[model samples]
Target: MLRPEIARSWWRSEMSGLSPEAPNLRVEPDAVDRRSRLAAAAEPVLAELAEQLGDDGFCVLFTDRESRIVDMPIGAGQLRDRLEGLGVVAGGVFLEETTGTNSIATAHELRRGVAVHGEEHYLEPFKRFSCYGHPIIHPVTRRLVGVLDITCDTGNDSPLLAPLIARAARDIEERLLQSTRRAEQRMLAAFQAAAAGRSRPVLVLGEGVVLANPSAVELLDPVDHIRLRELAVGIVHRGIGSPPPHTVRSVELASGREVSVRFQAVAPGAEGVLFEFDKPDGTGATARIVGSARRPGVRTTEPVPGMPVYVGGEPGTGRTRTVQSLVDGGRTRIVTLEASEVAVHGETAWLADLESTADDQPALLVVEDVQLLPDTCAVRLRRLIERPGLWIALTGAPLAELTGQGAALAAACPAHIDLPTLRERTEELPELVRAMLDSLGAGDRLRFTPAALAALAGHPWPGNLSELNAVVRAVAGHRSVGDITPWDLPEGYRISPRRRSMTPLERAEHDAIAAALRECGGNKLHAAKRLGISRTTLYNRMRTLQITT
Candidate 1:
């Protein structure tokens, strides 16, 4: 009998225009470079299990949530010519629509273990294979990380496969929990050493972690924390052996207190970097290693009293934080506008609210993602820019992109501040990492070891600070008790093929179009409709991409 979950997934696939016409499997070679948390957590468990299973012509596969195989399978005979020929290999998408009512896709969708045997598959070609799948969910977050599968040829299918797969998934989950517990213990131990004295603030550093003392936490704002962590993570990324060009940093907190700090890999009984702070009373200090890029747009000598300030940068490069830093909290109230968000009431109606700000009030109009604003919103913003009494601070992509949209936007704000990408001034990463750790809720407890820096620095940081922050948070969650090492880092980061090389959206579009054509018998018109695009657009795309079909 077909399970309800299986039946529904099959029905949904058919409804979505999936065909059993053997769509050339969407194989993402890029995934090969990605580090799979599931694979790592499942490894030791599977290795021991594989030994016990004893080469029973069965294979175990691990995949990301999307069902793209992530690792080499365990068990099974060495020869995999039959599986490879059927596109049942690493990087291939074995979703129900592509390969039919299979265990991997069904389990991924349902977030449970499922068994699909032989003739139950919707695709005829897949009927020769039997697969049982279990969803691997993160133990702490209870998030569905990926799917694990046990597959065999029809004659090798056994009733015991489901239970075995379930056991493996459980073991992975337990391992995840154990690692988290270990991280907490290690973090607390390091944090205590760093926070011994309340006289100065110190960032508790560990392998792949940057944590803050309560004093340090109070001293820096959220944005400062971000910058600090970026620097720390940068050090980790650059490798422990690579020291910063210089160590001392003299920074004025938003509170107007100027403090001198020393950044160096302090020699200790244990491993961790420490940022020891001191009063800048001419007693102890060194020239801070400043970033190379000048803040041409930001007025550092004096605050911009009333004039409009324009800030621009790529996503996750800290444009918002930069703009927020410029705000004079004592004088003006910060009113943020997400210009990119199209409200249900429409942009025109949304713009009308900006007019509500009277000239009498001292309000700073802050706009985020200005590059994504509609032309109508741009016109409205232009009108606001002309208001003499109105003070505005806006963030965008680049000056060129802003000007390309229209001159009104380009002319309104003449001074543009472009934030530096991570690749440009990587030397500042250690400091940034310090700030980032301080900003995170759990960061006060965690620290990064010297060796851990290499693991964090592996990627080119195409996503900039945004990606770095996420990776730091994830690594903190994944690591067990210890001074972090390269092994503690995500495998994806370690063997990264360079994610900055391609966008996921572009990859998804290319895969979808190619799959649509295969499913629709290479008919342009049919494929276009299936892809929800017009035939002319489809033809143009095909020609542009040099797709023969």
Candidate 2:
């Protein structure tokens, strides 16, 4: 009679579309994590096991959580060649779907120890050997870290094989436990050192752990704790080599009190960030506190009658709005002309319309994108500027950047207003975001958490107000109520704006995990499914990446 487990394994393999005649030996090069905690813990144990099995014509296979073989520590002579030929070598993926039923894939599928001998093997190519596999589980997380397998020639089966691999798996798990304990100890020690003398609210955050001084505990409410934890985790992941130094963010707590939190890593390899809180300066300014420099300012010269006024800024810097604000409310008649349309409508018609609008009545004429006008039109515009009853304003790039007709038109204007780029005006992010939300009619239903606003402040805002508006619109589309955290922002914005050291692979993995979480609305299980990794693997990666829920 077939064992119940083997029968189920065979059925699963068949359902996966694998043939019994041959096994798939394909490898996923990127699936293996050589530096994973599991691999590191298993190294010495596997080396010891390999020595004990020396010259025995036995092969030991170790695979990562993804079922890709990472090491073949004891594959000797002909056994190594046979395993390689069968796609059982290092880097090969041996999932049940790819290789049919075998000890390695079957143990991974069932999450238990399994043995397959001779004819019991699902594929014909594996009939010559007997194998036993045991899963290595993390002691702390109970996550399946990897599988340990040993294979020998048919009829050479010793009852000892199963127990031996089982023992090896336990040994690896123990080492993982020790590693976790050590990391926690290091993190705690650093936290203590930093918090020992500090009077202000201080806290250290790491994977699944948070340590806070009494001051922090008292100052922060429960909701504040969650947001602060998430913020620290994000920084740890974005930070390179050592913890980012002198990084500070101003955020409003759940209790409606705003504080500036200075962030610094506890120590290298500690995997925790220290939060030192302080009240804002006397002025209570909360934005752009990360750097020390003069704040950006908008400059404007009073508009003079009979002489055109020029408004200059980047595409999204509110140039047109600024120009419109100059007119007396509702009473002043306004006429507009777009110089960019001259090409499509013909310069004569455009110039004729400008002349007609100026002569029609006493009104303000606004010319947009004036840089697109021809030199002849500039002469016409200059002549129009002299009209006694007509007031004209030209809006386009800054005065210094304009040339030719645009330059002449801008210089002819007696008064000028120069708008600053969004990056230069980050101090206004909070009010700007609030005003935008109000415009979207979401102000009463949704609001950004302080950490979210801080993240926005760090961005360079290359697109100015327009890009910020688009982002707000996109976010409002998905959520209608409650606080919007940094986790809810799009992937690109979630990254720390400060530059730090990170390997390419690390950065890619970080981005992928962050994006998945955002798409799933912070659902870890769903995110893991979207990423094609098990929940346990996802948690491990999150901890490694310093990502928190």
Question: RMSD, each candidate, Å?
Answer: 12.6, 12.3
User: Estimated TM-score per prediction?
Assistant: 0.45, 0.47
Best prediction by TM-score: 2
In model 1, the runs with Cα more than 4 Å from the true position are: 15-17, 33-37, 96-100, 189-211, 215-549
Against the true structure, candidate 2 has what lDDT?
Answer: 0.76
Candidate 1 lDDT tens digits, 140-176: 6566777888888898878988888898888988986
Give the lowest summed-lDDT range of ten residues in model 2.
287-296
Give the Cα error of residue 127 in candidate 2, in Å: 24
True-structure Cα RMSD, model 2: 12.3
lDDT of 2 at 169: 95
TM-score between candidate 1 and the true structure? 0.45
